[model samples]
Target chain A: MTAVAVNNIVKTYGKKKEVAALYDISFEVPQGELFGVIGPDGAGKTSLFRILTTLLLADSGSATVDGFDVVKDYKAIRKRVGYMPGKFSLYPDLSVEENLNFFATIFNTSIEENYELIKDIYIQIEPFKKRKAGKLSGGMKQKLALSCALIHRPSVLFLDEPTTGVDAVSRKEFWEMLKGLKQQGITILVSTPYMDEAGLCDRVALVQNGKILSINTPQGVVQEFPYPLWAIRSDKMLALQREAAKLSSVQDIYPFGEYHHVVLKKGSTAAQLEEFIQAHQVDNAEMKTATPDIEDCFIALMKPSIDTATDSLNENASK
Target chain B: MRTLKFLLQKEFRQIFRDPSILRIILVMPVIQLLILPWAADYEMKNIKLAVVDQDHSEYSRQLINKITSSGYFTLTSYSGSWEQSLEQVERDKADLILQIPLHFEQQLVKEDEAALFMAINAINGVKAGLGGAYLQRIIGEYNREVRMKWIQFPRFNPDTQIEVTSSNWFNPLMNYKYFMVPGILVILLTMVGTNLSAINIVREKEIGTIEQINVTPIKKYHFVLGKLIPFWILGLVVLTIGLTISRLFYGIIPAGSFITIYIFAAVYLLAVLGLGLLISTHSANQQQAMLLSFFLMMIFILLGGLYTSIDSMPEWAKWITRFNPVSYFIEVMRMVILKGSTLVDIKMHLLIMCGFAVGLNGWAVWSYRKRS
Candidate 1:
């Protein structure tokens, strides 16, 4: 069963300027699937979550959560879906227990009724249940927010950038909690700017500039990169990057931590790039075939669109 | 119903947990009630009098003595010429100048009437008007005294003299505090009901909690009521404290039944809080809500007949008071607390307030969209 299905959702803001936040976006989340909308800030991830959760109306398109239309059956969808906005939206002055209980009661359910569902996440923050939510540290706040979102045992959960400001450890723990919820057959749609978090999802839609770049399983997205990719390491990494971009065969070049993950043109070999790097007198450069990850795939998919976007912008600016 | 209960629980918990809200709820009424009634006293006193005693006769001295001892005027400048006293008026030192003419005693005895020229600085209109009225009353008293001493055994010429005896009925002592306390209490209730509820929703908007609530299955009326009921209760709580302070400090017991006041107060809070929620629906943040609330409050409190009588206001201002909710509550408070007006007497006001309650709350609920 499809837990969430969005069809050509287009949303724009500002009546005069009409900046489109989402444009012809289409996707679906299957039942019990942990879906991720991976994008950087201002990429319309929050806008998509708000529209699906029925807090916002899309300019043009139809969406359904749990088989209920987002616009037509909003009330029914509201009952079945749990939404955690990008910002921490819980009452900061209420204590942890109060915040959790408050959400439970509004949904006409009690904490004891769904104790098993939120028990793991709740137990972590239960010790500080008396403390005000605003006083909690970043990780504890994220955990409390998740607990509040889950108190009603919603069938479809929408978490928009839940781990945005959280530390590394808490981010991992949060994903683990999402995994556990998915096991209980709750369809979760979570958005994040962190590309690494995409690997943990059952499927991800790489979103940029109000459109989806790709939607596939983690391995499928990486496997779909139809190019010979090379990771070149050298003492003079900056010089190597400048030199590698000059090569006729290099398709894309971006610095990825210790190595620059370089994509070569179709039918190009790694040896051609190596000879070019050596000829440039780049110090101690070593090249090897590198496995593409989601970040590499995201950049490869996003770069060409970005170039065209700038090209159109230049055209408009000249006019 | 259960959603409303949970929302109210959360609202009250938040209100109690934030010390700033508690301070506003507790401290505002106590300070405004205990202090404003005393400070807002409208019985003008300390009128600076510059007396130019040109006559310096026995009658002029007696008249000056009477005016100074009337407890209203302080003899600020006593000089020979009216010009010197005029200088006092120019310097802003004197509010009224009383000039006793030459041969004033002889002219009074021979002609049985005397002309006194008085120059009143008309700046600060209220002070000047009251000061002139006070001086005239004192001189009239002195005239009556002289008439009594000079007349024969028949104390009054009943046929010729027509004396108008006027007495204050409600609030017989004419205590300014008695009148001001009830009006101040109404104002305190208004601030608590309007500003608090206005800021409460916008605070949620600013902090992003309203989005979470918007996505819930909660009904719109339930959400608005959850915001309304607690502050409505808090407004009544503020009224209770204000009434207690008025009774304890100013010795003002309501002439009417407390039940009538509470009944009216309950309905009044609904209209005010509905207006607040309406503002919150338009506002995007706490600052916008606060500014809008303050702007409305300034207009409401000023034209609400708290400082000035509505009947005495100009035609345009009277129309504003007709629409102002604060004016109705202030009038109702004074009517019940001073005149012992029963619910039947204020039935029109009660009916209008009900209209306001229904209209404003209905409009608020209609405008508050759960989705945007």
Candidate 2:
């Protein structure tokens, strides 16, 4: 069975005329799969997690986790789901072990019962278990918070922005621990604003402006890009981009990093691209074909989907 | 029932885990128990006086001695004349100025009335009223001597020997400490325990722990009630200790039933702790909770009738005081300790306190969020 099944979920704040926070959101996660909702701030990732965890009610939709309806079986759902909110919410005055013990006790369980699940994460900061949770380092706090969430041996784990402010090393270590949890067959839904973390998920839902743009494996999303792309670079990059945009051969010109990656119009050659740069009085220019990664896919996906739908129709009809 | 036990245990652990909460709980109560009553009082003390004895006769000297010997007065100076005595009181150098007038012993030889004039500061009506009472008592004692001399003839003085008598009940002295200590103890306990539980959740909300709890499977009521239970018990502990210290050390025993006093105290703690939880649920951060609590506590203590009797309040205000849970507890506690009142007598008070507890707790639990 799917670990989580959310169909047509909706939650809105403010008056009816105000912005709808989550508009008809839907998704499903197979048991044990590591899922990620990758988006910027206000993208409704946290809102969806809230609804799924039963902390919030959808205005007009249905959602369930591990066969328990979020609305009707809220208490049962709370028992089965582990949620690490975007902020460090554990008791600050309690020692690390006390915070852990407190959460464990709340669920009517103990640390001994589910020691193995959180053992790896808990052991790292076990030496400082007597120190106040408030006084712990950010990374240690994250570790302690995670252990608190997992203490009940939940079937589904929801970590909202788990790697937001920690150091790169800790963020890397945290994800490694998450992978181990997934290996234990626990479904995980993690959210992050960092696009780079998208690649680490088994599947990612790219969201923007409170709406899901695409949901697929990271590599699969990248593979959906249709056109061959070229990175066009020159010392006079601004002039090159303007000239490239005006060129009949160039279909799109957008800067990816240090260089503008251009798509050729239908069948334009690299020779034509070089000739155009020269015609534009560009100097010290370089051009190379580049593979589309998650970043490239994100940019392509962000573009208004109207043109892509036409292209998709042509591709489908051709097939 | 089991859920409540679990919640109660959780509240205690949370309170114990936070040293600040414990300090506020344990230390604040003791401080208030010890310090507040000392600053609070009703009796007037240290009235300044200027005495003018124009009749340097032995009769005038003895009368002056009677007034100065009283502990209530600090004789500022002996005025040279009645004019100077009036100047002394009007200039604020004296709270009261006394003049023993001289008829050159003529009034006494004829066995007529010897007059004493006293001028008093009445700017503060209460202080002035007390001053007037003290002056009257001292002059009355002097007049008793005057009246006794004429009594040898056994003539009619109609007012002479009216047989003065006074009976003071329970706390005849009514030491302010006895009244204040109990009220302060209740205030401190409520301030500490309720914040410990309620603020923990709000703090979590602020730092994001509440969001984490929201996504968890913990029942909302269990989580909330669990938090409230520990603080409630801690409040009980503080109250017990406060009662022990005051009763054992200060000899301020309650005249009412011991069981009734404690039961009322427990019921009242619920109202206070519930109030704290209610404030926490509505607040967004620890700071907001702390500030709002401090403000609410101030209003509860001041308006709670700890400083003055609520009965003296205007009719509308006296009615408003009925809603103050602290006032009910104070009234009940004083009645039980000072008057030795029965449970049947204070049943109405207990019922009102129960209403406060149940009402505030319901409001607190309702304001609390089960979801994001």
Candidate 3:
């Protein structure tokens, strides 16, 4: 059974000449599967989560959560779905236990009834249970919010950028908790800007500028890279990028940590490009043929959209 | 019902946990209730008077002495020249100038009547009007006394007389505090109900917890009721504290039954709290909610007849008061406390308050959207 199904959803904001926040977006998450909507900031991931959770109305389209219509059956969806928004949204003044109990009681359940679901996360924060949520560190607050979202044992969960601003260790622990929850057969839809987190999901839909660039498994997305990518490094990386942009065969150049990931045009060889750079009197430039990751594909996908946006902006400016 | 109960528990916990909010809810109203009534009194006293007595006769002297001894007027200046007395008025030393004509004691004996000119500063119209009327009453009494002495009539006199004795009801001493305390109490209740509830949901929005609550299965009316009930109870508690202070400090006991006052207060809080929720629903942040509540409160207090009589207001202002819930509560409070009016006496006000409670709460519930 599909836990969430969205089709042709479009949302726009502003008073005049509305700017589209989501444009004809369509995706689905199957039952008990951990699905990830991967994107950078302002990529409409939050908008999609809001629509699926029935907190906002889509301009045009239909969605369902746990087989209940988002609009027509919102009350039912609200009962069965759990949502932890992008921000830490639990009552900051409320203690950890109070926050947990409040959420449980509001859903017509008790803390004891769902103790098993949040027991793991709750135990870690139990020592500081009397502390206010605002006083907790980032990791503890994240866990408390997650526990609140899961208190009623929701069938489906929507977490929007759950791991953003969290330290590396907590982010890892949070995903481990999510994996454990997935083992209990809870369908999860999580959005994150971290490209590394994308690999942990069973399936991910790469979103950009209110449109989905691609939807595939982690290996499939990396397998579909059509370019012979190369990682090139030199003492002066900025100068290297500037010089490489002048080459006719270089399609894109982006800085990735110590090396710059370069995508060449069709029919261009990395060996040919390496020898060509060596002949240019560049100082100790090193090059190697590299396998493309999700970040590479994400950047590659983002280029055309950015280009089209600027082109339309130019067209409108000329008029 | 269970959802509402849980929501109320959360609300109460949040309310009582914060020290600042507790101070605002409990301590602030008591302080305001104690201090406001003494400052809000409208009874005018200590009118400064300057008498320009050009007539040196015993009758003129008697009139001047009567004016000075009326207890409402203080003789600030005694001068024979009207110009000097007018100078005292100009210097702000006198509020009223009495100009007695220069008759040398012959005009009143020869002619049956004498004319006197009284000049008063009318800047504060209420004080001026009341002072003029008080002086006129004292002069009228003196005239009657003089006429009775001159007549020396037998028991078979031809003239018919009617003596009028007037008494002030409800507040026989005409204590302004008796009237002002209840009005100030209504205002305090309104401040608690309107301002605090206005900030309630908006604060959740600011802190982003509203998003979590909105995504739940709790009904809209349940959410609104949960938000309202805590403040409603707090409002009653504040009213009770205010009533206790009024009795202890000001020695005011309500003429009507406690049941009637509590009943009206309960319904009035519903209307005011519904207004607060309506404002919060329309606002995007706590600042906007605060500003809108303040704007509405100014209108409610001014038109609610707290310090002024609604009957004496302009026709349009009077019309506006008809729809003001605060005005209805103030009116009901005064009628019940001062006049000992029964529920039947305030049935119209109660019905209008019921309409306000229904309409505002319904609008609040309808305007609160889980989806935008």
Candidate 4:
């Protein structure tokens, strides 16, 4: 079953003509699937989440969560869905237990009644249950917020950047909790700016500028990278990469921290690359192929279509 | 409804667990109830008085002694000149000064009606007005003394055939504490519903946790009702405590049904909490909600007949008070406590309060939006 169905969603904010937060976007998530929308800040990820959660009305499209229309059936849908926003959202003044109880009470359930679903996660912070949520460590706060969100065992959970600012250990634990939730057959739709986390999702959508650039499994999208990519290291990495870029055979050249991750023309021979490097006298230069990940595919797919279209067409044409 | 009950329990727990909030919610109102009435009385006493005795005569000396011996005035000093005496009053050193002219005794002996000047400070106009009347009563006594000793006149008292009667309502003790405690309960209940509830919701919006609530299967009404119910229950708890303090400290119990008061107050709390929710729904942050709710609170209390009697207010202000729920609560509380008024007897006030309770909540619910 399609757990979440968003069709041609558009969210335009403010009265001014230029403020279009979300352009036409559409996607679907199957039941029990962990779907992720990976994008940088201001990519309309939050706006899309708001629309799906029925917190906002879309300008010109329809969305349904668990087969309920986002707009019309908002009330019925609200009871079956859990949402954790991009920012920490709990009563900071209230203790962890108080916050948990307050949220549980709103859902007409007791923590003990639904303890099994939340026990593993809640127990981690139960020691600090008497401590104010505001004063807790970031990791503990995230856990408390998640436990509160899932206290009623909603069928589908919507997490908007749940791990935006926490230690790596907590972020890992949070995703693990999400995976544990998925095991219970809870459908999850999470959005984040972190690229590494994208690999953990069952399916991922690369979104930018209020548009989805690509939507596929992490490996599927990455395998579609149509280039011979090489991580080139040299004594003068910057100068070497710039000199390598002068060769017509080099398709794209960009620095990747200490070294440069360079792309070559499709189907170009390794012999074509060796001759060019020797001509440039790029001292102590080493070029070897590397596998493409979601970030690589994301950056490749996010390029203006006109720029990448010719190369994609040429790569397919030669095939 | 079950959710509401649970929310209410959570709210009570949170408020009780925080000692500082407990102090503000419970102890502070009791202190105000105990101390404020005594501090705010309109009755004037312990006045500082000076006499400018220009005439060095027995009658003037006797008059000065009489005025000094009066407990109302504490003959602070003797002024050498009229200007200095007037200056003393302007400086607020004396509440009043008696200016005795050079021929003051001669005029009193010869003239049937002699003018004795009593200059009173009138900053607090009502107290000043009453003080002048009190001084007149003392002067009348002095006149009777003078007439009886000098002329040997038969006293024909006007009160021989007339009947004077009066009775105090609600609080026969006339202890201002009795009146104030109920008023403080109203204030405390309003603070919980207005300040605390408003901040609570706005705090969620500020931190973005409202999104979590928004995405939950909990209905929007559930969300709004859940938040409001807890504060409403807290308001009731504070109300009960405040009422208990009033009864404990001053033995002032409401003559009306306590259950009826609680019921109406509970219904009225929906309106108060609704007001706070309306503020929270519109505000972007807790600070704005806190400030806006407090500002509205100040205006409501000022016009609520808490400090001033609505009946004594100007017609325009009286009309304004008609729309103020606080005014109705004050009137109903005073009526029930003082006159043993039944709900049926105070049906008009109850109707107005019910209407307000519905109207404010409607406004609150309608004003609440899904997003800021």
All models, DockQ values?
Answer: 0.74, 0.48, 0.72, 0.49
TM-score of each: 0.92, 0.83, 0.90, 0.82
The TM-score between candidate 3 and the true structure equals: 0.90
Maximum-TM-score candidate: 1
**C-alpha lDDT (0 to 100) for residue A302 of candidate 1:** 75
lDDT of 3 by residue, A1-319 (tens): 9999989999998887278889998878899999999998899999999999999999999988999999999999999999999899999889999999899988999989999998998899999999999999999999999999999999999999999999999999999999999999999999999999999999898888898877888887787677789998888888889988778788888899889888887567776677756965557788888899989877877787346433443343223
Error of 2 at B32 (Å): 2.6
Candidate 4's residue-wise lDDT over A179-213, tens digit each? 99999999999999999999999999888889777
- Which ten residues in a row are the worst by lDDT in model 3 chain A? A309-318
Query: Model 4, B1-372: lDDT tens per residue?
Result: 776566556556656767877777777777777787678665567777877878768877877777667776677768658888888888888777777787877888888556678888899677677767777777777876776677754577534555557887556767666676677678767777788878877777778767766665555676777777667767888888778877887778788888768767877787788788888888889778878987888888989988877888999999988887777777777777777778788788777777877787778778777643
Order of models, best TM-score first: 1, 3, 2, 4
Cα displacement (angstroms), candidate 4, residue B253, comes to 5.1
DockQ of 4: 0.49
Global lDDT of each candidate:
0.89, 0.79, 0.89, 0.79
Clashing pairs in 4: A78-B216, A78-B217, A79-B217, A89-B209, B170-B338
Best by DockQ: 1
Q: Write the per-residue lDDT of candidate 1 for residues A78-163, one digit (tens) a residue.
A: 89888888889898888899888888888899999999999999999999999999999999999998888998889999999999
Question: How well does candidate 4 score on lDDT at residue A154?
Answer: 90
Q: Can you tell me the DockQ of model 2?
A: 0.48
